[model samples]
Target chain A: MALPSVSRRLRHPFPFAILAIALSLSTGVASAKLRVVASTPDVADMARQIGGDRVSVVTIANPRQDPHKVPVRPSFATRLHRADALVVQGLGLEHAFIPALIEGARNGNILPGAPGYIDASLYVKPLQVPSSQNRSQGELHPLGNPHFNLDPVQGKRMARAIAEGLERVDPSGADDYREGLERFTTLLDEKIEEWARLAEPLRGVKVVSYHNDLIYLANRYGLLQVGTIEIKPGIQPTPGHLENLLRLMKRENVKIIIREISYDPGVARSLAERTGARVVPLAVMAGGLGPEGYVDSIQANLEALVGAVAESGSP
Target chain B: MSFRFHVGRESRRGGAALALILAAGSPLPVGAADSDATTLHEQLEATQREAERTRDEVAELKRHVADLEAAARSADATPTTTARIAPVNADNPAVSFVVDTALDVSTQSSWQSIGYPDGWNFTLKNGELFISAPIDPFLRGYASINGTSDEGFDVEEAAIITTSLPWGLTLKGGRFFADVGRLPHWHDEALPFVDRPPSIDRMIGGESGSEGLEASWLMPIDLFIEVTGGLYDAVGSENLETLNDNGFFGRRSFQELNFLGRIHGYVDLSDTFNAELGGSWTGIPRDEERSLWALDVTLRHQPGTQSSYQGLDLGAEWMWNSQRFTERDDGGAIMSRIRRRRQGGYAYVEAFFARRFSVGARFDYSESPEGAADRARTASAFVTWKPSEFQRVRFQFDNSWGDQQTNQRFTIQWTAFIGSHSHGFAQR
Candidate 1:
């Protein structure tokens, strides 16, 4: 079968011309909106708060999906290709997929350690930093737990980082970003106090979580974490571990269990039946419960915790 | 004064009196001598105490110096132990090894034709060692070596890809699996079934990879579309004798080199469902000029609200080949041309009902390569259990019918990976 030569194939100009024209038209009009690609929806929401209308935000991980297992799709690379800045939750939270996406995107400005790259975790104090880097500890992040966005205080810090990153990318819009950040922070401050007051009754409450993701929230509200359903970070609980956890919960009089919406609730429910604990499925990020903004999701999480503790009785 | 007088009386009183008499030339006053002797004795006592204190200070300083020396030695030893605990090799590339083993049981007396023996044969099919690293700011390199019981060892894929190419273009050079169809690009261990679909195996000769340079362009569009083209010396494995150095083609010309082209497009119907369509073409020149064309489609549905493992995947691939052979007379002159055309396809549907368990079925059909009147057909069902991301076990049952022969085979395959191997999306 004699196929046409490469020169003859190249001579056909109609499709090539159409493709070139389409690409030019699509990219020709340079909008002033800063193209911001965030690692997760919560970070995207924070970027939106800081950037307002001055930025266009694209989130890599869906709100309802597990952040640890975000799929690396070609669309992510496409979005990152045109981005002026990239915001990440960063202390290895996006380790599995973000690096590959950045590599695929081939955008030098948004690579790690570059000016347009922002690590939101940098502004906030990390939690659960292990003393030893041991594989037996399961999938532990070497830097620390990367889920500090659960704490509203850290959310404000993340907003500030996003603002700084936007300023670096689009210096002309720096004033707008700063003003937006101030307004968001003021609102966050009020919510934090209100959330603290609402959570006063549950202070020092003994609780068990399905994973170690709730440490920041627990620390914020003074909830004493007695145990976890999973044996380690990212490791499923063995029967022996579950048995020990059940005994510890019973002994400690733990009556509240917090679990992320992404995790299966069957184990939590089984433990609840055994120990009379109320299982509360909370959103790990901004979108787990629904399509919520950052502040709304944190508020929803606070409400879920308070209600579960109240129903389960005081510590 | 009285103590001095007492000392002089007890010890060398005679000598002291003699010296006093010689100096004074007369007996001096006892009170003056006693007072002078007392002052001298007190000065001597103070000097002895000072010397003793200085000796004690020197001993303490020596002990501290010894402690510091010991601490310095300990500090020197600490890193070696710490390194054993957490070894650091900044230049080492991310490495992973995957072992794929299978147990096969067949009703036929010998399955050796396909590299498996009948009646509960345990085969160490392949152990693949993969290494990948960023070579520099502009390029990244990756290599995979597969060691098998039969083939010993072979460089399955070794390629360097350009990272910072302009216009969303990526260039890859070296040996790699050509992106001809969905299944060919995937390693056998990453495949959904225990083995390659029968039709793909028959049509493309198992895995269609070659040593070549491939350039891919990601079209700057709202949707995902990638166009790729490459040129290779040969289209298949080392065993593809028809395309390799066999006397059938005599001296091959540069024009006879194999060429491959493919275009893949992806679209998301919704947050939960997405579909991909791809087409590929390969031209191979031999005594009989041959060209193969393939089309593949895949649909996946995984709700964002649900676990990733709980999803549905459906896929299909169609392949057609055209071969033209020029017949020669006794004088080595071409007499007539014979043309043969063959087509084959396979379709599969898989559903994951739980996080760890999945069930799938595939149907394969192909026209006989020998131009037999009857077509070859096979049906297979497989159940897979993935305990974690690192390990998977699958049990598959196959029944094939062709050439008026029916064969039944059962296989249990286990595949596990260790270390860092980021292949982006999970195996479909």
Candidate 2:
């Protein structure tokens, strides 16, 4: 009888230890709202619109910095440690820093394959999938382009994914999350249609960008992408490469040079001065334009493109 | 059963079969044999025409079915959903290899003796293989093996780190770099300079690594403060000279074990500026009375938009050492035992004006730790360029002047890396 009692006591700690671990990994359980962490400002904005009052959201990467090279700050890990759900842009966009932060967070709830880990890129069709790649070929995204957020139509899919992600982390608020998602989708749909009509002038306008961050936006409208200022995707432009680009621009009559606000405008400005083209400083992510929401960011970029194209086409 | 396809062919076939059966089975009346035969012949001809039309319709139906099946197959081949981007291979330990080679020219005749190569020498400075992985839910593991042309491969570090402890506690066990100061904790390739500063080289022994167990606590306060304590069987590099009889404090008993304590604090001064300050104490508890104390500070500035392109770094560290040394009389008699107090330090500034380039200058001053009258002062400057994330090239020049010796040296180093190597949060 004594042996049996001792064995029972020994068995109790194992279950208790597991319970403790479970409690540590689960976040915002004792609070009224769920905690969500997004990899970029665009995803954060979308999560806010979809989660509404039922959830609180935090962004990891700064919108003013290049998305590819966001520094992994220690405070970001602390935020992730207390988050209930993590929504990532995925498609290798946050490859450099997000993985390190997640591992440092030590929060098993948001690890890959877990219910609280949400990859919004899963809902959108990927573009520019390389047939072959190597470092020598420049910074090519092996999983295709990850800038789907720039496409206004892809916003609907990203919102839906975030809503479902919130519901998964906080099932008690499933009804609220679904209603919030519906409201966001309705407004975004109307805005997308209106923006498309306004972008008619950019349909046939030849355009170039500082980097390849504009493919999704170009495809959304009918803009003809003729060239890029950079020699390769992430490679800086050399003089020889610039010479070729200028010739191509002149021959193609490219009227607009689109540059992300995060990049230095030196090269793009030089190119524009030589080719008699207008330079358009566009925001690549939400909040890149100072607290602009996701819809407003896209509209701002679209208007910049349209205004430049119209100005150049005037007799 | 009913089908969506036309049944015209089947209907014609049924009529023809019925007419043929009637013609074959029925006997003609004697009187109307000719007329009946003519009627039967006409009906037979019509039945044959209907059967032909039915055959044609069936052929067309077969072709349509083939086309529909083909269309479905093609549709099936097109992927409806984009494949998830494969996450970086996190399930397996990240394995990486690095090779460092250098061309050296110096005033010293023997490169190996001075820790710098002689005139116009090519050397394979170091080769390293690094691996890291999450061992389980509770611990993550990391290892680094290094080799040189002169010395064969050695296990530089192999440690297990705690992952999911209840509090803000981290525990590390096995061989690792002692957190005595900022310089001692950094790997050679990660250092901003070509070589360790002379002050650190003389005081802490070139590479101050040890086999030990360390535990750190992240203080529960707004300021980023972490305190670490470690216990080691011995400390210092085996190849270095000086300090506790050839740059190492070996423990013969449990009481003689080496111990270290460090407190590090970091603060974000502004959106583009941050600073870190740390204090460290390390000593061996034995009759020899060996101890070292150091304080370090670092400040960095990087604008949000041009973080990768431009930055400024200012770092400095000061150290104090006190050790017991026995003096010998000229008559080969023990004169006395005295504890010597010596001080040494280094300061450096680096500026990154472009995305791929940075230049830095450092000054070092240190007194002999052996209670001798010799002291050294050195000045050094270096430029580094990174062609890509996986490769680096650097050129460094140093001028040293001391009571015992004066020397000048120049070195060019190139390093290449492959595979998924990462240094965790400390890389930035």
Candidate 3:
């Protein structure tokens, strides 16, 4: 019995101990840099700004694709599986896909309500919070609109939150994250002032948009939104709705029409021709127009707004 | 307590002395000593009354203090009940319903020719209701019930999946589709075509699933590698009759259970192209020991800088089955053991040239399971129009050739989903 017991003990000697040692060594290397998964390209850019050289980032939604219709791919799950932290726009913007990916990834550190999870919307006040949770409101976000990333001031707050999230997961790099956040904030503040000055002529300018995605951008530049080309949030425009929108546009004397690049430009073009308003196609997210980063993308949008207003004459 | 009593005693003595002085100073007194004595007696009585009053007030204060102590105890108990009760989660699980119906027009005149009594006719192909929710912090549950025009209803899938297992390990229990092949794992509504490929349907059965427990691990590497293993009571309803005849050959021991294993790999070649390859094996023991092996490859191309709808999907799958049967003949003598091996597979290519329109073609080939029948071959083409993410309509045509039989069929399918759902019908 003693010999058999000795043989059995030898057969499984130190298996768990070996596993523990291997895990510790692997985690030691992995803990040196944070891995972040962002729900959209803009959030990915913000995380990059905050994490700098201490982080690696992957984005789920591509810039050219509509964020509302992002496909749920196994690749997204794989990326999330290795993520140490997660940053999302919240307000139900990524409701369709992000939950499934998180569940599939099976990463507890990034689950909702965890310390490594960052809901960027918590940092900035939301707009268009619906008074009623009714389907008749037409695809309304129950919490609020989740397009605050387009505003540089709100983007700064979102970057700060992401930095805090990174620091929570990788505390040794807390000082590095804080420095990165400060540098990003200063650069963004200066840019915001410059963009505001360039957008001065667009103040009080009446405009129509293809969808409600431009609300944050319009608010930042002091544009008065008149109407939308769509009858509802995701619904196609009916003839009656189009006629009513045309009448309202004429009455309001809308000077410009802003359309996202992801949407079909045919409707925006026809409306502009009918109303004599200049049509401006804007890249709603970073990397949509080109490989531009966050700040440059926002500047490009402002430049487009200024050029559109100049073409439309004085408001 | 003693301090209040001392003040009460002092006040009573002072009142008695003052009353004595007041009576002595009265003008109507007959005898100064007798008046003073009466006045002292009345003052003493009044002092006794004041002491009784003060005692009663003290008792009342003690009763109030007891009541307050009782109230504080009751307040302490209130939160225990309230805290034990928690508010329900407002973010309820997403529920979705999908209805897939088709109008079929086939050259075959009778349902028998199509294998099913209800086939070869316009029918409700499938109506599925799906419910999924996170059970807790560590697990999520999903259940789907399907109804068909021919078969009334069945629980298609009811599974609980671990969401927080370490090392990228996921454990799933309850009934689910067997991870045998690419097509079998996909729900009918999630299929790219109107009907399953002829080879898969003829050889391994279409949409075969079983009650099982599965554990899958995603390897910790740069490339996506998943290894999965499962144990099931039976492979599926299609093979249940063939495997178990309710005799000695029926499932009686653990050895009769089905065992399945699969290894899948995914690689991203470029921003626009990715490849997925998988190999699967399953074994079941009974009077006839049946084993199946399948290999699948899928290549997808979608430019990151373009719309998601514009893409190309090319896939191919090959499956082989072997069965050995031992049985006695009608003459009460042992018959020669029968051994059969059949092979089947399909290859398909689909392209989305426009945002909403997609076209695809498939070629299917299979060896007949029956000894007398010849090989079967089929060619199919389909076009799908998706107006939105939740709705799709497809038109398909199939041409088939087999021993002494030629068949042609046309199908128009309409599928729609309603309510909140994470996985759409055509995500695969």
Candidate 4:
């Protein structure tokens, strides 16, 4: 993907300089490659899926890893330094470090005015914005929830956003990006039905999750909302709260606990043990995930969730 | 924006001990929240603020190193000046374009419309032009020209990182628009769910950004340690006063952005347990308001801490802050109400179970010497599910009781990331 042919256009007045090396050696000869960096494996995969060979990617966080905890190592800075553009999961999802990292890297290509930065939340529908906007309560994303990376329909739009950001950074690769998007969507459309079929049994099934994070997925698969493992959205349940939740789960007759692999299974596992329910491991993103890309990663989770449910015998 | 710690004494304690268990993983960021918000945001903000400073400190150290190196070696001794490479072929028909430009138009039609959240017609919400080209391995930049209700056409960030120096040093100068909390950059905006960590309101509701000069260096420690520090116009008096109230600092009394510095360090042990320790101090603005200086340490255990606990990320963040809030003549913090000191310490245990699932419950106590428990000790939890890669749906609910008071909030969020397919990997 390092099409170093971009050097043909410039006659550097300075023989030895940093910018010269950047232009003559690294950037492409005919077209500067879309140097894209995605926050998570899933997002990275999606970019690659639609970006094809026209863009060079340096994925930051892995799929299997907890993105919230991913460190901003020197390598990450190096990745940011070289990037012509960055494609990130918007919605404040990577709210932890990506913003600061981008600022520190100080690459002019991505400042607000540049086309080197892509925020994927613009096109997605916002779900749980606070009914009231008041600091008296706590910090809130006035724009809405910052998590928009898990919905398939939104996923398609995200791809389009990435493609647009890429085009701005590397306009010559427009055709390639277009073709990549077409192929990516073609595969995505096919995969959706297959995923639905695999998860057919889960449709209309009452289920409980360790966290309410997977609402998009559950809704997509037609999983009914039962309850939660935590007492609040961020605060974990104390023993007393857990005891009460256990009582509620038993009363509600919740049969399965759908938890993501990145979460602490201790509570969910305990609940499953107490209620004779099954705990299923769900994959979150693409990188750190089983497959090579976003679609494959989701498919993997779909299959895994279905497999966990089918074996649990929840009809 | 996710929070981790709650406020009050009768909150969930010893959760750090649970960190060793398979259930201790939390998906929320450190101390980016407050009692009024979900516990996740408080913990995230507290956790990240200090670490971010340390990184800055390291950067400042590296800048010193580079400057020292230059001084040690005379300009004449240098064989040849560094190269100034021109950009790649600007007219390559097949590849010259290396940026994406798009106009994002969004309109909201709300029901209930509390506070008239409805009727706010969506305009051309944002216009972005992103470029990751230049092909320089040691340089990068990011920016966004936005038209949100706050400030129109604001430059989010416009800086550069040049790693062509020794000891991994880099230079950065321009506008700064980075938020403090968990979740990287604005990616939180693309979270699978709709509701953002409450910290967003606190961070952005005020003035937009701090402009200045920043320098950094990647340390050569046993592990990965980075130092960064800057001399910027501190947070203005308009919202966050990052200067002293003495009214006699740096031509202050009317200056924006203050003099602040920070340093950060991190280590990854065995791919499962990771530790990041950092500290930072900022000069408050010139006003009657107090200043802030904070220090924090964060540790995370992964893989179950590596186990069906799938990917368990358990983090315990402890922060000690010397943050001084201002009280107006009427003893109010804001113009309309009372103001007081919000100093002291905060700590929390954060956990993220799955990629799409995260929850943080924390106990934070802040007293103004004569104020009530001021800190709201509450329990909060969030369920996030990403049906696909581009969209996230989140259900956020909290059971918070602070100062003998109880308040509960339930929110659902759906976030979508859309790409402008019309523009591909093409740029000028």
DockQ for the candidates, in order: 0.18, 0.16, 0.11, 0.02
Worst 10 contiguous positions by lDDT, candidate 4 chain A = A1-10
Model 1 chain B worst lDDT run, 10 consecutive residues: B109-118
lDDT of 2 at B378: 81
For the second chain, the TM-scores of the candidates in order are 0.74, 0.74, 0.74, 0.51
- Work out how many backbone clashes candidate 2 has: 1
lDDT of 4 at A91: 69
Candidate 2: residue pairs that collide: B9-B54
> What is the C-alpha lDDT profile of model 2 across A145-221, one tens digit per residue?
99889898988988888888888888998898899899999999899989989998888778889889777888889
Point out where model 3 deviates above 4 Å: A1-31, A131-139, A236-255, A266-276, B1-92, B111-120, B240-250, B304-307, B329-334, B371-374, B423-428
Q: Report how far off residue B97 is in candidate 1 (Å).
A: 0.9
What value does the lDDT take at residue A271 in candidate 1?
A: 93
The CAPRI classification for model 1 reads as incorrect
For candidate 2, the TM-score of chain A alone relative to the native chain A:
0.88
How do the residues B1-428 of candidate 3 rate in per-residue lDDT, one tens digit apiece?
78487657858686767767676766755686686778677877777776777778778888999999999999887775535645486657778989899997878543232352224677789989999888998888888888989878978889888878999998989877777778877888888899877677666666656777999887665455667889887665556434545665445566567777777767678766888788787776554566787889999887633355578999999988887766788986868789888888999999986656899999988876663255777789999987555678999988777663677778999998776544421134
For model 4, what is the alpha-carbon lDDT of residue B117? 34
> Considering TM-score, where higher is better, how would the candidates rank from best to worst?
1, 2, 3, 4
lDDT of 1 by residue, A138-206 (tens): 778989999899889898888888888889889999899999999999999999999999888778999
Q: Report the TM-score of candidate 3, chain A only.
A: 0.88
Which of candidates 2 and 3 reaches a greater TM-score?
A: 2
lDDT score, candidate 1, position B251: 42
